[model samples]
Target: MKIAVAGKGGTGKTLVAGGLAYLLARAGYTTLAIDADSAPNLGFLLGLSSRDEGAIVPVSKNEALIAAKTGTAYPGVYSLNFTVDDVVLKYAVPTPAGVHLLVMGTVASMGAGCTCPANSVIRALLRHLIVDRDEAVVLDMEAGVEHLGRGTAEGVDMMLVISDANRQSLAIAGRIARLAQDAGIPHIALIGNRIVDAGQEQVLRGFAKDRELVVTGMIPFDPAVVRAGIDGNSIATLEGSAALCAIGGILSRIDQEIKERLNGRVDTEKHS
Candidate 1:
């Protein structure tokens, strides 16, 4: 399953990615969670500390390829010899619940000329690193579909657009859905993060319907989550945390949707 979680800033996209990755791993599936967001909070959420640059791998093509593509003068003798996997790092963090994790480095925002490299880096490797894998991969993408780059939107299986109660966040999520649609991405759903109670749900559901997105689930603004983060604990490892409970519900729905989609595809293949 290739699940990509994207949303406007501060919508808790990274948390959704990390939660699902942790959930699937605990469910006995080997999972790879890629933190493709420019801010890259998954490392912090997962409690991974690394001074080594290896922890944050770069997405540069082979030095030769980069030079060739950019028409840059070669610095010196070089051999083009690294495959995509060579650039990814495995962060093996132990969880009491037996969920395995592997984290990728961050990307800069899709901002200006200075961000061109990060954007290109994300665009280039985004495809091969995602849909071409056997193990389930979850991508935590930046707000909007900027990470989809150009002409490769078909690789994403499903995108969960995160949003808070704020209108700005909701507005951006609608834009994200449109971008995903433009990228030829097939499925999109919405997750409203930081909902205080069910009373706020009326507002959330109305916004979701107005935007033509599904209000899949809601995560409460739990202080336990904050405390867990403060102590450098994995949200996945948060015991008796309300945030985790809500996230688990979200994961269950996602799993069901994946299974139903896969089953439907199998039926289509058989009838054809």
Candidate 2:
């Protein structure tokens, strides 16, 4: 299964993405977590120390690697037909959470149709990971779906648009859900995070219902999650955390949804 976690900034989408990746890995799926956020803090949630996370370079910023993959003999010209299947094997960082991470950084030219070399490499690599690879992929995307071009977005089985009780966050999540739908993602669902009570849950559900988006799961306000972030501890090691438990439910829902969708497609093809 391939899922992309996206929401407005500070809505805790990265935490959800990382937590899903860890759980999928624990469940015996070879999982790969892609940090496509511009700020890129998913490393912290995946058990990387501050030093290690800081030392790692994002794929878009990796000048040498980008050149090797797309550079040409002529100045200002680059090739687009090079293979990117080896990028994961060569650059994916193995984390303590047992999930490999590929920090793609921000695809600045994404969706703008710019054929720049770096964008080419990044886009191709993302498509390769999502479409070619068999492992479960949890992508922590930027605030919007612009990073996901049509081809890259189609490979994702689901897009989890996370939101909090805040109105602004919910609004952004609605927009993201619509964008993911337009991008041809099979399943687009909303995940409510930091929910404080039934009222907050109701609010999230109401918002999603109004927008015709499904609410896959709701994560209650968990102080332990806040403390873990403050203390620089990985959620993977934080047992008995309510937020993690909630994310586990979300993961199960995502898995089931993808399976059902795939089965439905197979049935349709058989009938056709």
Candidate 3:
């Protein structure tokens, strides 16, 4: 299963993304967590040491790798097609949370029609991970709606748009949901994060209802999550935390959705 977690910054999307990866890995799935954010901290959330995380290089910023993959004999041109399957084995770093991490720094856009070599490499690598790989892939996408274009998230099983009760976050979540839907993402889930009470939940649900969207899940504000951020500890280490418990419910929802989809497909086939 491939899942992409996106939201306005500071909505705890990384925590959800990292938590899902850790849980999936612990559940015996070969999980790969991609930090596609410009300012990445998924490695820290997955319990990668500061030194180790610091030593790692993001794929888009790797000059040698990009040059090798996309470089051509021409001075002003680069190759547009290359196999990126080997990149995972070569660059994915193993974290203590049992998930492999790959940092894909922000892809630069020179113009509306421009396609830089680095951008090509990232697009191909993302497609490989989402459409080609068998492992459970969790992507922590960058803030706003830049990361997802027409086909950027096409093969992803689900796009979890995280939001708080606040209007700014919810607005961004709505925009993201629309973009994901336009991108042909099969499942787009709006998750309310950092919810404190019934009022907050109501606001989130009311907003979704007004917008004709569904609230797939609600994550309460857990103090343990706050402490983890303050203490610089990984959410994987917080056993029995309320936030993690809620995330567990989200996992169940995802599994159920997938199962139902498969069953529906089989039913359709039988009828046909």
Candidate 4:
């Protein structure tokens, strides 16, 4: 299963992505959590550290350089420069948690027509890593759903849209949900975060009602999550805590939904 956790910046999308990876791994799926954001953070969340030992391979594409390499050949004929392995970072990380991470390569500012080449390579590598490798890959993505272009991993099993209790956050969340729809993404669910006040519930319900989106689950405001992120604490190690309990339920729903979707697809194929 390929699941993406995304939302506006600072909405705890990475936290949910990291926690979901941990939970999925614990369930024996051999999960791979990817930090596809240019400025990556899933590493810290998953409790992995590089002693600044390995080079941060810039995954960005220098379209000009690549064009030069192609020597006036058609852009379509220009082969990609980096391999999937070249961009994937194997942090000399030691964790009993049993998961792996890949950082999306990054580069500085560029021209208007230039989208991050690293983004292209990373997206290709992500497709290879998730669909080709068939590993349970979770992408901790940046805010905009624009990252997911057409004819890519548009077939992902789940497109999780994370949001907070604020209106601005919900606005972005709804926008992404529409993006997912435009691509005809198979599954889209919302995870509302920093939840408090019963009124926030109404806002979410209204968004779901107006947009017809799925509220997979809600994560209440929890300081444990804050401490966990700030301290690089392993969420899998949290025991007998409210935050952990909430996470457990969230993970359970993910599992249940994945199972149901897989089963539904299988039955459909059989009938056809």
- Top of the candidates by lDDT: 2
TM-score of each: 0.79, 0.97, 0.96, 0.80
RMSD of 4: 4.4
Model 3: CA > 4 A from native: 109-111
lDDT of 4 by residue, 1-272 (tens): 78888898888788788778887888788788876666776665565555321443333434443343333356445455545553334432334567777665453322123444444454566666656667688888776554555555465778899888788898999888887777667789988787776788778878887888988887778877777766767666555556566666887887788898779999999999
Off by over 4 Å in 1: 50-57, 60-85, 89-121, 150-152
Worst 10 residues of 4 by lDDT: 107-116
**Cα lDDT, model 4, residue 181:** 79
CA shift of 248, model 2, Å: 0.9
User: What is the Å distance of residue 167 in model 1 from its true position?
Assistant: 1.3
| lDDT (Cα, tens digit) per residue for candidate 2, span 61-160 | 9999999988889998888889998888989999999999999987765767888888888878888888889999999998788767788888888899
Q: What is the C-alpha RMSD of each candidate to the true structure, in Å?
A: 4.4, 1.2, 1.5, 4.4
Give the Cα lDDT of each candidate: 0.67, 0.88, 0.87, 0.68
Name the better of 1 and 2 by TM-score: 2
lDDT of 1 by residue, 1-272 (tens): 77889987766787788887777777788777776665566765655654422355434423443444333345543323323443334333433334434443444543333334334544555665675657777787777665664445677667888888888887888888888877788878888888987767777788879877777788889888777767777655675677777888987887788799889999999999
**Ranking of predictions according to TM-score:** 2, 3, 4, 1
Rank ordering of all candidates by lDDT, starting from the highest: 2, 3, 4, 1
Residue 167 lDDT (model 2): 89
Question: To one decimal, what is the Cα RMSD in angstroms of model 3 from the true structure?
Answer: 1.5
lDDT of 4: 0.68
